[model samples]
Target: MATGVMWSLCLLVCFLIGAARSESRALQKLDTGGGAENARAPPGPARALSAPSIAHDGRLVACSGKYLLGFEPNGSFAWIVPLGHMCNDSISPVFEGEQVYLVAEDKVIKVTPRNVHTAEPALEVFFSHNTTSGRSEEIIGLAISGSYSSLFLTIRNRGLFTFSLHGELQWSVGPALNLFDYHLGCKRNVSGCYFDSAPVLDQCEGALYISNTEGQLYSLYVDNRGIRWIQDLGSHGKVMTIAPGNSACLYIVFPRKSIVVGIDVSTGSISWTQNIGPISIEKNLPTVDSNGWMSIGSLDGTLYSISPDGDMRKFLAKTANDSVIHVGPILDCSGFSMYVAKTIVEGKLIQTVGDYTYVLAKKPSFILFTLLAPATGTVYWTGEYPGELSNLLSSSDLNDFTIDETVVLTLLSAAKTGISNTTQCYTRRQKIACICRQAKAKFVQADPGEPSYVLLLIFLLVVIVIQAVAILFCCIFWRKKRLQDNGLQKFLEKRRSLHSKRRILGKKILELEQRAAEDASSNEALGQLGEMVKVKEGVERKLYESYSLGRDEPSLEQQGSSLPLYHDKYRSHSFHSSQKESITIFNMLSDTSSSEDGTSSCSDDSESCSGTSSGEMELDESKSAEEAGPSNTANVEEGVQHELEKQHQHCSAP
Candidate 1:
């Protein structure tokens, strides 16, 4: 599990390194933003930005002020698109499929990464809000429909809006939430008749859920283009978050009341509602674990776990009033919980007497990170870091270090007790490997930014490429070994055939030993046996020049009127087998499996044995087939007829 999270982090780190590689030499003199963004940020204030989105291919896309930028996965800029109007620095750009949707002042712009060079990157306005002359009409939230062909957004007090993904306005609904606007001190008859929350899609039932300030929930159909249902909970507060619940319901959180309600996705009916406790901040949203228990945070410095049936259990993270539970609980797939809290500490920003211009807050805070046991909320470990983090929600730094723990990475841009304008980066690993960035200079100077992240990407890329190449070569080598074994099988069969013929020749020459003096047929038999002996000798010599293919080829003497060599063959022991070792492909698969030679060599067992490898046997059979054949048979018969006449004439002279 840690390995899986490491790869995901490697992807994020690699893409960030890719962006840093495109930084110009002049960019080093400024802050760490790109392009038209350098003017918005100086050497200080590292927060002028939009939320960056990582594509499936690992490219990072984000917007700064009025421009959209793209970075490749291997460290280079792909394209940049400019929007004429300014964009909200707080709003995050949404990437759906291959396109990007982001807010630009009063318009929602769609960008296509592929056609950035050929055409305008901001292809069209997906939706545009008609603004009232004096009031602000910024988009509150943006989400894409499950079909990936539609978009939904909530304009502050104006209501809910929907559009086709390709720049077509489908429909709009003005919520009836403004009846009690006087309670919140809104003007008598302005454009904001109702305050609406962003639309959240529940993919299970094909519906979108949204809430008004009066606690009224509206269910809208995604495909048929109409309002499905609406229900009011009879409470008044800001709808802080809306989440898709376990199969049957949709969960909504109201931070003012600290109430979490589960609304049925189909009928907009409230099934279960429970108030955990009052939360001091709105960042404490709820998260559901693997077993369907939802966990949330409260001002009491406690983590609360609520089951789907509305049973609530609380575990104390700190003594009440000692620490602030600023963020909610986060659960991995295995039900391990992560909770964040902080305690306000009274300390000055400056630690030394030297002249320092970068003054910090009088009460700088310290953050607390706790890893809790699954479902029990038992503390596994707590990490405390200096400096303040607004909330841990949606932090890209969230990563798994073990099956149940995570590595904590903290970056301090503004130091309260260090040299002026210095930045500190700290990492704590839990069963994971990490590289720390070290800087020795006391004063803030222009150092090469993102050096450690670049080194990490370079190292990971090199290792993965080498492992792939090693596996490929191993496959090729084994394939060649299989083919050599097949040729050896054919060579062994040929050796067996020649040895059986040798046994038959010895038997015939013995039978005709007496008949050579008495009959003509015996003379012919004597001639054929002599020719067979010579053919076997030539083949065995050519094939097994280095090792014996069979016992040394037989020697036949043409002493007059005799098969005398056959008569004395049993006494001489001429067919003894040679012993020689052979080289093998793999030592583990030694040559013990080789077929033994035929029966010509042994006087007792009548079976010869020799040590020859698969490679040597293959070589011997191919050479013998090419050189020895049927032409030698016809010549041997003519020699036998001439010799018979000389014996007959010598008898007549006697």
Candidate 2:
């Protein structure tokens, strides 16, 4: 009878194991593409823009034409304010502390953060000295210098002027009009010298540096109150921007030459000059951090981070051109956070923040969809029929789908189709259900969010009931055993041995169960890794095929093939390149071999260097270069067109 009971228990355990395995398999299969029936209607139509600047407190600030708009980190509008007047504004508005500063037609205006209604001019300064007694001078150029306390403005025809935060004039210097006469003499029919570019303020020396369209750079000593030094860059295009860091000056020129000239701040002597072609630099000025590394965008829609020593450590390509990235890239302490915005060919705005990027593309006439990160730059997630919105909604199904509340609200407000109302209702319901499920999961996973006194009372009651039952059973068993004393000592010993063996067996069974659980988890992780690899491989193959088909000229194809491949190998790869390079140097201090591969391999005992569980695989650099070799231009162009069509279809469907 005891043997039969054991066999029955073993059979039951086997049945349970089989059932669990079968259920897991069923779930895996169902996850492939089976959840479309419950999907909600598509979201509404709205135009998308990039929120590039984030305030110190994490508010996103952006410029849309002449308007300065502010939004929360989640893309909800905080406020919008228009500039006083628009005069072919090229640069994005700059913010310092609590005030926002803007420049237009040689006029400088400052406004307080509280005054964002309309275009309220708190203070304005004009600079144009070329006019006669009855005529108003055009402020040819304007720039803000120093901190918010000591503001400096420079104009083209006029010299330089300093003002306080309250708009009180501090001092005036220079009608430095003929400073670039020698440089401008190179070209016949040259107009008078103009200082259209903003002067960069040197906080350390309390001086200002301004350049002209004639390739002349001038340094003005604030204390000395005169020109320090002026250097002529021969026949170079207009000096677009200046970035001062590490006591060195970096100048960016436009049209054809994108030269990075480093100059000594104190002496105004050239330290090093590196000239990159026009395609290498965008109109947006490069941003420099506390470290010497500089990040600049290119006309070819790529972002490059160049080291102080002139090494290109990292580059991100395929960035759309939506808005001018005038504000330097933002860096967190971890070095893995930065943002960039680009305008697509369709006038859609796409912004990428940190490792995640979102593309807000236009759909048909009235609908817009914002494709989430990990979906961008790939055909599988982005190239499905009818586009990202329909694909995402259909795949997840409305029952478990999660929509960003701000996006949902914005879509609802902008909706024009009948599906808009239905989508709104479905999103609201899903959000409520998601909240409830999250709460329940939290309750089950850890201690319930209830009073400690209540939990203590329940625990005490359970313990009391258990003790009472055990005591009653002991009393009954002892009485019964006392009545039937047939070799009771031997029986007790035998029973004790059996219980010990059973306890040991139970412990072994538990150990096996734990091992099985771990194995199962590992298997699941491996499966996920495999899937990601396959997806990436497919995307890469497609990209290569497109490249192969798009080239018209062999030389151009060869040049394109020579371009570097940029992929983040880890989460920290998104950090500013400087920080990653610094960390690499720090790790290399202890190990000599680490510097060779640009990464420190971990030993078995070093927990800090443990391999990431996800195992993000990338194509070898050499392999990538080889695969990117020259292609036929006609084929490549056709391939690109096809890819675009595929992407369009993916983002547009229901």
Candidate 3:
């Protein structure tokens, strides 16, 4: 029983492995030209990293490692070209009139796609370059201008090279703009930048616009002018996509700056700049519609439609797990109409025209191609891609694409035919009614002020007026404050001047008081001397009068004779009194005059008078030494008193 159980388990494991392998095989198949319900997978070789490019003859060209494979519309291999080495990610085919040009590392090969039915296709070796001339470097971009009949090839660090249509080297420019350091042995960016996108052709201006990892946009004039201008757009990763506006402007996107700059094609002048979000990868280039609205994708699952004038309309796709949109958004056949899908899986807008839009997306983690209404973005039917589709291409951009009226008419007829099932019919009716309801909501006349737009406008006007008034008042206040500050400065200066004057006055008063004190001390000493001299003089005059009275009888007869002598003595006394009066007037005038003037003169007078008095006293002492001691002394004393009293009166009258 144990052996049987182990064998049963082993068989179950083998069956599960077989089922997974078969499912993978089924997923790898292709659908050919069968109907959507009865489509089957085609047997084709494995693919590589190369993406599909639409050829001039409506064929799909792709590079599988070292080989170039061309596929038919029904998803079958049409032709194959074996390259000498594995092609780099930058390798791409530039389709011209009859020949397709393919650039592999150091060489470019030319071949005609019409000759695929032959036993073995012949590819002409168009051109080859060595490592030094720059062509030998890894190729980063390829482009062709049929109008100018020239080819442009971009290689790492080797600027831009122009060639004839037949691959004849015209002129090569060095040190091409790249994301990495253009000079050798420079360590700036470890990732190493290069040209990652194809060059876009401006047929009208006869120039080619391309960008490099060095964050530069270059316009190469194919003629003798060479490089027209180089605009430093800032570094962008591998997703540098350039889109053209209607006639004048060329739009270049910078994913790192999350911006798109519009440059004039002829003059290379910047026209406008816009800020989009962090852009999605280079899965699709910027798509412009007839109305000049561009559709751009962001990594955050947001789709933005920008107008030529820099107006943007945005929509976000809701997803369950990882809503990062690695693929950029592509425009549909209709102008601004977009059919977007949102769910737990991936979705793509395959085709859209007017009301009918198709979405090749996954629902609930399962692949489903849904038909939706364009106006309302409502899903109508969900189906599969018939066979496992690795990639899908719209034929509108192909050179040989021709619209078939019959196919369009058939699709119209099928859409008009109603679904038979009740559940499906009900769902379809509900989706169709969605747009009508939206239209009714938009067009139905609203109540005059349901949104209070008038009130809002009035409120905005009032706010603006208030702001203006506040600004005016602020200006007036500022002006007044400035004037006030100026006046305050002047007032402070005046106050300082007044304070200085007060300080000077106080200093003068202090000096006057000091001098007055000195003058008071000197005057007190003079007053004391004058008092002593007056007392001595009064004593001498009284003694003289008493002596005269005692001798009156004896001199009665001599009195008449001495009368003249007395008259002379009286006259001398009057003269002395007059001199004293003059001295008194001078002293009074000096005291009323300035202290500086009074002190200067008074000092000289006081010294002179004191010296004279001391000399007179010395003379009197000598005279007393020569005469009768007491009598002579008395006479000398009396004479000295009289002289000292006169001198004291002159010096100390004030």
Candidate 4:
């Protein structure tokens, strides 16, 4: 069971929205005045920390024991989300879509930055795993696909695991990973394969490249999942870091050997190798600018910029007594700035060219980041922070990365004054910044819904749809009106005739009922009364139907109905006068007369109707239906008289 913990993070609902695009990399100027020290870590009690990692949206995230803290680009506290005790050994979190995925111990947890208005819980345990042998596998690092839709997790002493965004395990390498035996086969002088960092994902080739501690380079295909290739470069100490090159090459840095090896991605072969001086930099990877040059600060006291092709030049070299880079030289997000992970250290005077400050323990060390021109090695901006950055994770793409023009001129002036990296003042702990507000490169948003045009387009489409619906309804009502026009008068006549027939049937039923009472045993009168009642019910039903057919028209007012009226008045009027008689004599005669000259031209009228269009046919059918329902006034009266005469004759004969 995983121990529960509560965490909180501020939700920027508009963070990825198009209207907020300009705001993403925009760093609001932070005020360092009012009780806050000019150079210090975020205000909190000292605790175990992790290296800061940058989110794509420019938010800075790092974990302190059970709490994960996010800072704005301007170094202001953004939010602190709680975590579980199982997530105590936390690595940097990765951002995908809107959720943050973090690996702690053997569990993968997802933290959603919920909007303040949302009541949903933010933190959830996505996955928990242990080796089949019951061995606890601590996850080392997490790598994401170039598309940011999938993830790959590397566990110490265990194999790699790839997962989809929805937490479905896509594939796994091994329950017990022996990279040395499987990939390297213990062929070279290497003894064991240890991975200390996440695999570098080559988005172009759709493959993953990783180097073990023993210099065993391995590549795995993303889409294929299982197939892999490896190359053994003997041993170059523990592989410090691996970065992508201009082409399909992997730059593997071995700090212990002070060597950077470029391996061809396709063949898994070494392309070139450049020797950097005695290397002390560990976690900081070289910054690859747009020009395809890699720049890194080494313990040799030189900032080395190497071309994509095998070439290296010292961007900045220190004299024998000059201080060296202590913490960073880590590049910024736009590939335009460099910042050392801010930390606290105690050292002697190093260099305070502008607002840059770096403190080291006891000895003197000048280590930080600089905005260097790839071609000229011009230092536009540089800064240092107070304290060790062991556990503090932050984004390299932090937005407050610019400095003022005067500060750049001051630092540049030192080159002419021959006093560069000379002016130094020792400080116990300090945070520093200079205004270098250069233009930020524009990034195309994934969800491109610009209010300037997309909103207008959406609105126009909505209006068109509404208008189309209105027109459709109008046409429907107009068609209904036409149908009513063809049948309205015929329906009215049919209704009156039905009423008259109903009256006649009522009188006949009363007479039969009276005769039945007078005889005391006349079943013939009773039977006739029953039949009359049934016919009366059917006539009343037909009358209700005629009114309903014309009910939709305003011409048909809401008259009080004597019975249940139904829709489709035209069809209702066609209902039989009785179950035994499908068509009444009165209705049949009216229909025959209305169609043609009695029955003589009925065939000609039907032939013309068959050739009519659907709209005309509908109207004709409605009219015929109405006429078929008690529309022949002469016929209806004569039929009633004939029925009464037949009844009287039968009674007189008996």
Give all candidates' CA lDDT scores: 0.50, 0.43, 0.49, 0.51
Per model, state how many residue pairs clash.
Answer: 2, 30, 4, 32
Candidate 3: 10-residue stretch with minimal lDDT = 560-569
Query: Which tens-of-lDDT digit does each residue in 117-201 have in candidate 1?
Result: 5754446777776888887677887778635577888888676777777667777766652334422212233344455566776
User: Candidate 4's C-alpha lDDT?
Assistant: 0.51
Best by lDDT: 4
TM-score list, all predictions: 0.45, 0.39, 0.45, 0.47
Model 2 RMSD vs true structure: 45.3
Per-residue lDDT of model 4, residues 196-292, tens digit only: 4676776545788765655566678886454467777655554557776544556777765668888777687788988875544544456665445
What is candidate 2's lDDT per residue for 1-654, written digit by digit as tens? 999999999999987787666544433322342323433422322123332444434454544344455545333445655555653344444556666666544456554655544466533433223455654345543445434365566555554667666677777765343444643221422445555556676553456777765666777776445677766664455545666544244434342454566666656666665654233233355655433456655443455565444555433343334322222333322121223332233344445464223435452222222221111221111122233434433433222223332223222222211231212222322332333343333434544335544767899999999999888866655554422464556545544433433343344334543553365223223222223222333334433332222322222211111122222332111112322321110111223344455434443355554334223324364454344323322333344346555756887998
Which 10 consecutive residues of model 1 have the lowest summed lDDT? 431-440
Better of 2 and 4 by TM-score: 4
Candidate 3 lDDT by residue in tens digits, 1-654:
999999999999987787666444533322121112323322222233354555555556665456666656544456666666555544557788768788766778887766755676657677776787523366667778776788887776565678898667887754343335443311245245455456676554567777666656677776643667776655333346787654456777765556777777667777787776554344435655434456666554566666656666665544423343344332222222332322334544434454233334344343222233332343344333222321232221111122121112112222322122321322222322332333223333333223545666898999999999888865654444323555646544544433433343344334543553466434423322333333334333433332221221222211110000011101100012322331210122243566554442223257674554344434344343334234433543454446545755898988
Top of the candidates by TM-score:
4
Ranking by TM-score, best first? Answer: 4, 1, 3, 2
Candidate 2 residues lying further than 4 Å off, grouped into runs, are 1-53, 62-68, 81-84, 104-107, 115-148, 174-191, 247-255, 280-282, 300-302, 312-314, 317-337, 340-654
